[model samples]
Target: MSQSLMVAFDVPDKKAALKLAEELGGGQGKTAKVGMELYYKEGAAVVQDLQEQGFAIFLDLKLFDIPNTVQKAMLQLARLGVDFVTVHAMGGKKMLQAAKRGLEQGALESGLPAPKLLAVTELTSISEAILKDEQNCRLNLKEQVEQLALLAKAAGCDGVVCSALEVADLHQVVGDDFFYLVPGIRMANDQVGDQVRVATPAKAKAWGASAIVVGRPINQSTDVKTAYQAYLADWQGSEQEK
Candidate 1:
């Protein structure tokens, strides 16, 4: 597979998402991310629509239920022909294993490529302060992320949705081939918004991220196409430097 830069289509509904998808044209090297809000509103039809439009769907539902429930849900999502899907590593090894099994089964049944199962370590919106104080954790941010990533790997997950700040550490521990999908990517001049562990695109690529999930910097930009192209340039330039 080619190196991807996923534009998060985290809009309100299917109509809005399709509008953006039309403008961006998921051709080039771009991929589309469908998160909770839009997926809940539009469901499988939205997935089908995007696939038909030539976009590889990165379904970001972050499944975090019991083993049986998560397995069943992944089984269904697998049939959608999504290119990527997320599950929370906090759900433990059994749940991740169950999810992997379900995804494999679904792919086998449908005779389709199984979506890469990415395990969520921690939300980029979360801070070290929040992890220590709010979440009541002893481990620091990097340690916690590393631990979760190990568990995800042990359970046969293909990759992790980690903060850009933690991607290097994860890469060191997990090595290459275990995907590192970093989120919380923002342009250097852009405001951070709700994200706490943000990094610029160049920084993310330098840290060896497999892919970066970018949202508002492109979506909310005044010149969406130019902004999107600028991000693509950053990633390409970074790769060439490597």
Candidate 2:
């Protein structure tokens, strides 16, 4: 399988999002992420449009709700035929299971392949202090992330979204088959913005990230195709080195 380099279509407007999607659609990366910002603005029609253009979508809503609500929502999302979607693992095993059940039912009804359900282990923007002090999490970040990832896997999730910082250890716990859709990717000189646990594409690839979700580095670049090429080169070179 070709390695996934999921670009985050984190723009606020539908036009800009569509334009970016069009540009990347002609590039090597075949997958793109649609988060709440654009989805709420443009709805599932945007996803359908992108899919028609031959790009797989990762709906990154990071859903966190009661089982019934999440299940209902996942049903709708699954019917859209997205390649992946995310739920908050912090919602506990029952919620994750509920999400899986919904995906299965929706895909069955729609005659589409069930989207891979990924659990959000932790957000990349959150720092150690926020986790320990504000969130009252006692375990260190790595330990907590591992615990969540195992919980997600046990709950029948196909994967988890973790920081590159936790990818290697997560692989040890979940084994190599579990997908790690890592975010918080930045080029060496790119600004980190709000992210706290950022890693370069080469580092993320070397550390065992199954795929990396890159945002600002590509989105903010003057030449998006070149930036994407650089990231692809980084990951491809890292894989070759491995």
The TM-scores of all predictions, comma-separated, are 0.95, 0.95
Worst 10 residues of 2 by lDDT: 21-30
Q: Write the per-residue lDDT of candidate 2 for residues 28-103, one digit (tens) a residue.
A: 3378799999999999888887777677889999999999999999998899999999999999999999999999
Candidate 1 regions with alpha-carbon error over 4 angstroms: 1-3, 26-28, 238-242
C-alpha lDDT values of all predictions: 0.88, 0.87
Candidate 1 residue lDDT tens string, 46-153: 988887888888999999999999999999999989999999999999999999999999999999999999999999998989999999989999999999999999
Model 2 vs truth, CA RMSD: 2.2
Instruction: Give candidate 2 regions above 4 Å deviation.
Output: 1-3, 25-29, 238-242
- Residue pairs whose backbone atoms clash in candidate 1: none
